[model samples]
Target chain A: MHPLVLQYDGDSEEKISKIMTEEIIIAGFGGQGVLSMGKILAYSAIMQDQEVSWMPSYGPEMRGGTANVTVILSSERISSPIINTFDTAIILNQQSLDKFENSVKPGGVLIYDGNGISRHPERRDINIYRIDAASEAAKLGSAKAVNMIVLGGYLKVKPLVELQNVVKGLAESLPQRHHSLIPMNEKAIKRGMEIVNTVHEVG
Target chain B: MKELKLMKGNEAIAEAAIRAGADAYFGYPITPQSEVLEYLMAERPHERTGMIVLQAESEIAAINMVYGGAACGRKVMTSSSSPGISLKQEGLSYIAGSELPCLVVNVVRGGPGLGTIQPAQSDYFQAVKGGGHGDYRLIVLAPASVQEMADFVDLGFELAFRYRNPAMILTDGALGQMMEKVWLKEPKPRMTEYPEWATTGKTPDRERNIITSLELDSGRQEKFNLKLQAKYREMEEKEVRYETIECEDAEYLLVAYGTSARICQKSVQVARENGIKVGLLRPMTLFPFPKKILREMAPKLKGILSVEMSTGQMVEDVMLAVNGLVEVEHYGRMGGIIPAPDEIVSVLEEKFIKQNYYG
Candidate 1:
């Protein structure tokens, strides 16, 4: 099945891929697999024959605190790896939202964990999608899968990559031991997708 | 040929080095330049291109490995920010005196002792006037863009081998950190053979070649120095490169390079917008020093502003280039801080405009 349609329906192929070349930032607290998630997304783009550069931010104490990664994927060779601002940012934690919300381009998407954030971003111009990714991951009996859940939510909104491509990428990239875990990750991803679909419907 | 891709300066340098047919890279992790190492590690070019990337024990070890590889006529390189490059100067001087060919990249950071890992241009004299003791010069190419950073690898290695000397790419934090579109250059054609002078294994037909700077006689050492000076003179004739912006009808010229030149480029636009006849002279090569270019520009120009990220190292070179042909002024913010474009504009306004600045 088409990955973008897994969570989002009624979208033509042409309309779904308008921003596929756009730069995105995936940022959150440490241990959220933010870097890996960005890498997979970036690799997916590269697999589609697009140019990509993935940059992970690490201070002297990256593991002890927040971490972020900037992924620039384009048809052209990417210059300057650092993103002064983002066309879209998928923020999984509150600190990340607060840290980068202002820097997002007007009307840019901000995907956040609904279970963690108590307040909606005060800005009216920006598009905000709240996914209960952590709770969904907990329901799947794997809190560590929250990142995968969030990635699914991101796939729904952007749909720059096809779901089948992501599945193939995960299969090729994951270790053998982790291959068994892909089923659960896919389930968690679907859960996150459903939450966004429901919200996009009501709004 | 027509597409623009955003890339960082450090990544560009690494991509460029790979395309330039560099066989080996040995480097220690350092800020603003870690990406160069990281990109090579992830790409793992060894499988197809036979490039070797090693994370060395220390900067000293890294440079030594470079020395060993370069001794074998292999295209080799090492990169670090500031403090780390300081540790490699001893080896650099030896390589210079031994007349070896290699490339070194110093993505500069603020410094003196464990300075912050931010951008700075304080290594101007270290790179241009020779960092290690004795009279030697490196062919230093200062890149202002990520595209240039990748393109300079081929140019740097070509010049290094041509002159049988070390070449350096002096870039900084902003360029390393910032993203801009870049088109990677086509790889250069590989040389079919090393120079007859390269150190290969000792052959039975010929005596074993010794790569050393040792000279037991004072006269021999003096002769070596004289010969080195002649090589530098030839380089001065052939290798000097600089960029001029808005200078044809400008009154004041701001001299800078690398990331500083990027800022000066912006300053020129701002100064011009504000009705100040200001322009920039950015030296792309710090060691052939571009003295002749400056000497020619100085007579036609008003006062010169030598803006740097150090406490004025390149400013001294700028002054030497002018040689009292015109009054030279300088602005500096050391310890790794980048001087603001507005501050530079203000300096041009006050020093050149209000002070009746004239050559």
Candidate 2:
């Protein structure tokens, strides 16, 4: 059995569950796995018996343009998937940073990859963290795992869902052929956790 | 029991259709709803249960194909977005006139013609008020969640067959595109037997069944119209489905369906937090419209507000249901726009709470 499968059974009833609602937006270029990152988070939330909604920006906007997704995870039943404001914004590029930085609610968190951001986040009311996810994934010898790295940085800060549940979620999201890459993705996540730097903390 | 899968609403509809023992799916591709066809084709349900999945060249052709399949007493379905659904209006009217049992899903986008591909409930009038020519009605099921998207396929089919009337899954682009954990039902085998009324190569021992809407005789056609009216009345009595949240103590009521209903649900929570006695009345079946509940609730509420993605289509129904027993107002975002929860709360405050509005 996978480690996550074991964790899934053990954590239920034995562990004290926290009830929190987090509305997050993941934004980047079209092929940067922004949607996938949101999907993975949503699936992880589901594994923890949390209610989640994942809404992606689709149609022509997905043709080599900015791609984004809104994910709301809650202990209670989620009301709506479409939200204008977000508790956290995981920005992958400068364009996404410019578009979504102001949309983050005050006293919330903003995590961004420093790869393409020319201007740092200017919000003083929210907590901001910068992670070199691209470099971390490149160092891990798997450039495609940038999303996993960013996701790791997210979990490190919020820790809304358990890491093992995320691994189970990854297994569910990825096809059977890509299951071999789970270990690499796990390493990328750990690297992300290690390298993330907090730029500002909310008081 | 099958484990829950994180699936898109459109994909859920496709999977649910197969599990509901749908015999065939003939649909054309459209934004926000193309996933329904794509998932069915990729899964090759044809091999899974001998269910025929065909990608028709056009929406018109798809609806005609559905008509053909339903005529032969097969469980058939088709899905499309707003403009594509418009193309099937003629076929929809004919199906209603002929009293065919089939499912038509309209994952609506913003449109008077070719509009934006985002979510909109602008097609409420089109769905409930008879878009095609002649007087007819479809059992319209509006899903607020991805789970309902999966569940309603079976329910829609059940209702369709029970009444021998066409049923529609009226959803918007947002609900179709959004993803959630869906607990899929066990697969049911494809329907092998149809009703005796089905025209499946009638034998010499039995009289041939002719499936059509062509009653040229004026008296007979009027009688058929009367029969349809009686059937609709029966449906209104039996098929009215809705959900009320915090309505028992509410002084203000929000009438909404589909995606707008989901947003209004959040608004209900927000309004309650602000010490406002607001509630949400979500109609699960739009055609039946939940008029009886609205009529009963109207006397106790200060006012009713109909929130929609379109420009006041369902508000008309709300007003008709309330029938001046309560003050009714409409707040809407048109042309692919969706109103936020706070926006709805503000609208509620400005329109109802502040004015101390009462009917």
Candidate 3:
């Protein structure tokens, strides 16, 4: 039996392949915890026995400039840690929105915070969602929870990883001294999942 | 016990070195590869396996440190980026010339002279054909993933000792910085029994052991050179390693190594999805160059494309191997810019399926 057809009911050959391989790009400012989110996501995939690769943007731009990371979670061996397009792009800032809005493959998902985004995503071929994570973080009195909120918004839409695995990933990646903050981060994720607003849906 | 962990490439290599029972590591920190020294320092291999990890003042100093450790037949290694690698060339030549075993890792960045701190395979030529001035070759292993980054440290050390020559893991910034899951092998205790040629001091029961690359007599130097050539030939005959994907029915083949090879794997899948029969040939051992396999696969291939992160370095070797049995071309993106997978298929289609049709 073909691996791609594990859930097959004698249907289409291209059935559900996009779900098998999730090529995600998370981009924002240097201190946005963007790389950490990618790491946690990669670790979560590892706990599920999925092959994962995380490549970060560590050029001159990452020196207090824009930061980005490409995270791939796949059932098969992933090729090319570097890529031009993405299956999902979690954009945080205005610059990232402008750069990667059009990079989402047709019928893909785009999740971004509405904080710095002045000109919103203008693509109609992909599904776009808005999360006011900055405001939500301010409400929680923890500005550092912005990334988790946005990551939560991403999970509500895709749910590619189990919630328990994500929590375990959060605990595993965090230092023992910082493990007490996990509950707050989990709460921020729940708030994000609740507040994610749909903007444009392709289908 | 098999330990699995999600680790960056640099960290994996550092952890693997200690587990491989390496005696010492001397290195200077450079971007895209700084994590290696950092991880080593944090892990404190001196505590784990009693291995010595030192941060040398410069790349030159570090490679010489490796040379010193290797002279005593210790499993020693050093790592650096491009400009730092250029600084260690003289030391590399000396190590190769003296027939000492050592591992040198060049986590390559863009270069001519300090080009960029981004990933690139421009060092392919420098790595395969001796960068330092001499008639010698370093056993070069190009690792494509974080797993290979960890796995190659042991393989690199094994090969270096097998031939009594310097071995290098020629990876790029992308592989150095990326994070992936790797299953680490169980630890091996450090070697207490050194090789016979080691400078372990003269004793009443044995003759004095000397290690040097200098031979003042021209005739003796030529003989040494011939001996080195024979060693390299043996390596060529026995040590060529590569990986093939989707080639059973492939009409076109993409030859690449390291990060470029990873990208070409995706190109093979994309081309196949488009009803095109494409395959990927990834050379794991870049020094031995995988010439024998290419020669055998070339006759059946309608067209061959050499994809690299640099501009046409490895293509020369591919063209030489194929000997024009099939049409060959080169595609690349320079200055730390990685080529895309889908675009590689487009180049294959344009180059082979478009106008020129020769086999």
Candidate 4:
């Protein structure tokens, strides 16, 4: 077993087990791993004995354009997997924020890249968390790994599943050689966790 | 036991097909309708309910795969948007000529060729009047909402087998992308009952029924054509469905379907707000064309304006249905351009205002 798999605490496990029934949405441009993020979240929920649904939005010209996905995790059977509004929205780009800001239910959490998104959203009713994950991941050598950094941001706001459990889910879901990439993700996750923890402490 | 939940029209159709005991689904991806395939892929009911789903190389393969599956007496369906659906015409016509039962869903997008991924109801004539060569007809169902999207799956499949012909759900991108509350029924737990006429392979007593369109003899081919026409007539009598909106004392009736109907609904509301007394008649089934209702309503109205996403495909149907009982005119936006309710209302005001008031 990898150290990343064991990094999750018992409290996170209890939290995940307690409220595994939740709907999550991850959205961004084509290369942002929006679909894979939904897949990982759905697979993790499935591993936790929850009913899961993952829907990816892709068209013929979706590449290099706007892309998004909806993931549903619930205790009971889900009827239709398409989510018109979301409880949690992870937006990685400005277009994702623009297209999805109105779609978040009031009081829902919105996690976005602070560096990538310049303008603050006009609406202040919903909970918004701006993460400079792109810069943080850039320090870790792979700017493309910003998705994992945002996943870190997701953990702080909606930590329904344990960080270690997510790592384990990724390990089980991804191929073998990809296992080497886990440590960087764990680092990114910790960086994300610190931001949320600081915000809570200050508030 | 009925319950309502908000759903997109595309997802509702997928859930409804699952509930209707659809045994197989084969399709290629296309916008406005991709959610149907995405839903089936995520649900994977094939593993639990003995269903099968295959993403084919193209729309041609998908429809042919459906024909192969339907020949085995299995309830199967395939869906595509405009351009992709045009590719399935050959297989659709062959299925019709062979009298096979299958369902084809066209969640229409704007098109002459990949014109745009926006909603359009331009395929009315292709769906109802037979897109391919032959004296044949497909039972076409046009759903206007998420709830109806789900309900029409069962209705389309039932009528497909009932008439031994292909049934089409003629929806548009708006219906495919919009969301609403949908009440889903529990899955039907039994195998679909097929008629003895269906081509089940290699059965001892049946002598391996040949499913083909090759009646070499001219008289035999004519006999098959007449038989098909008779079956279509029976379907027209039994399966025609339409909705009349506030036409009790209307002077002008707007004819529309699918996403166009939603726009027309708004137009009717706005026109009524202006005291225009303009009502709407939406044909849920396009093939049967709701000819009887239009004929009956024509005498009561001054004229009918056939409004659609296509330039004038459905206008012809409106003309045929009214059979010149009253004046008929057409208003449309084509090449994937969606006409707004206000635009349609302007056409109505322009066309009818002079005739009714000035005349």
How badly does each model clash, as a count of residue pairs?
13, 0, 0, 4
Look at candidate 3 and give me any clashing residue pairs.
none
Worst 10 residues of 1 chain A by lDDT: A1-10
Global fold similarity of model 3 (TM-score): 0.96
State the DockQ of every prediction: 0.05, 0.32, 0.40, 0.03
The residue-level lDDT of candidate 1 at B269 comes to 64
- lDDT pick, better of 2 and 4: 2
* Off by more than 4 A, model 2: A1-18, B356-359
Off by over 4 Å in 1: A1-203, B1-5, B188-192, B204-207, B355-359
Write down the TM-score of every candidate. 0.70, 0.95, 0.96, 0.67
lDDT of 4 by residue, A81-134 (tens): 444678877888888888888887777777777666776555566777778777
By summed lDDT, which 10 consecutive residues of candidate 3 chain B come out lowest? Answer: B350-359
- lDDT, candidate 1, A1-203, per-residue tens: 00110111122557535535576888888888887787667656656767776666644546658888887777653433544467778887778888888877786777777677765566566777777788777778888988889989988888888777777657655768789987877787777678773233212
Clashes in model 4: which pairs? B5-B181, B5-B182, B6-B181, B7-B180
DockQ-best of 3 and 4: 3
lDDT of 1 at B302: 76
What CAPRI grade goes to candidate 1? incorrect
Pick the winner on TM-score between candidates 1 and 4: 1
The sequence of per-residue lDDT tens digits that candidate 1 reaches over residues B1-359 is 33344456788888778778888999999997899999899879786477899999999999999998888888999999988999999999999988999999999888777787767888887898899988898999888776678778888898888898999999987778655456776655444566666687777888777888788899999999999999999988877787777777778888888877867876776687698877788788888877887788788887899988888888888898889988898898876566767789998778877775464
lDDT at position B55, candidate 2 = 92
Could you give the CAPRI-style class of model 2?
A: acceptable
* TM of chain B, each: 0.95, 0.98, 0.98, 0.95
